[model samples]
Target: MVYIAAVVAVVITALVVGDDTRGAAGDPFGADQAIRYIVFLTVGYMLARGLAKAGSWARRDDHG
Candidate 1:
């Protein structure tokens, strides 16, 4: 969770500190791309956390 949050902060900071000379069409890391990256990161993190919890829960049930 901390790693994901750090990555998101870095992405946002990069977007803000990036050069502004390039046109929107020419920029590869535009606002849309950043948003997509953040969304994907969040979803992936959530899915991973859910799977981890499920695995632990199953293990606990089996042991108990």
Candidate 2:
């Protein structure tokens, strides 16, 4: 589910960047910046998940 959400977010972001309905001023940071931000966010999420899983694995208690 998280992966699906990420994919959808990326696609929507791409569409918004490609859109050219803005005024003559144009985008503030532009498409390249937007893409970089999205990639960074995705990596952050993956790293968080990995850390959480590792923590859980290390704290396992076999005794009930």
Candidate 3:
């Protein structure tokens, strides 16, 4: 959720600011770059979460 929100904010700012020229801070990314970054973040987060949950287990005992 945080990643999605951040990317959205960045893309919105870039579009609204309307400046892609290289400045002291370097060139700002466009919408396409933002989309790619979000995709990478999503994939990396999924992999990390999957690894973290791989050892967890839960059960409901009916014999209790």
- Give the per-residue lDDT digits (tens) of candidate 2, residues 1-64: 7766875677677667645765677755566766786788789889999898877844456665
| Residue-by-residue lDDT tens digits, candidate 1, 1-64 | 6856867785876577546777665655667777776777778888988898877745535765
Number of the candidate with higher TM-score, 2 or 3: 3
Q: Give the Cα RMSD of candidate 1.
A: 3.7
Off by over 4 Å in 2: 17-22, 58-64
Residue pairs that clash (backbone atoms under 3 angstroms), model 2? none
Worst 10 residues of 1 by lDDT: 55-64
The lDDT of each candidate is 0.72, 0.71, 0.71
Report backbone clashes per prediction.
Answer: 0, 0, 0
Candidate 1 Cα misplacement greater than 4 A, ranges:
9-25, 58-64
- Please provide, for model 3 over 1-64, each residue's C-alpha lDDT reduced to its tens digit, 9 standing for 90 to 100: 8867876786786676537465667545667776787788789888988988886564456453
Candidate 2 lDDT trough over 10 residues, lowest sum: 55-64
Pairs that collide in candidate 3 are none
Rank the candidate models, highest TM-score first.
1, 3, 2
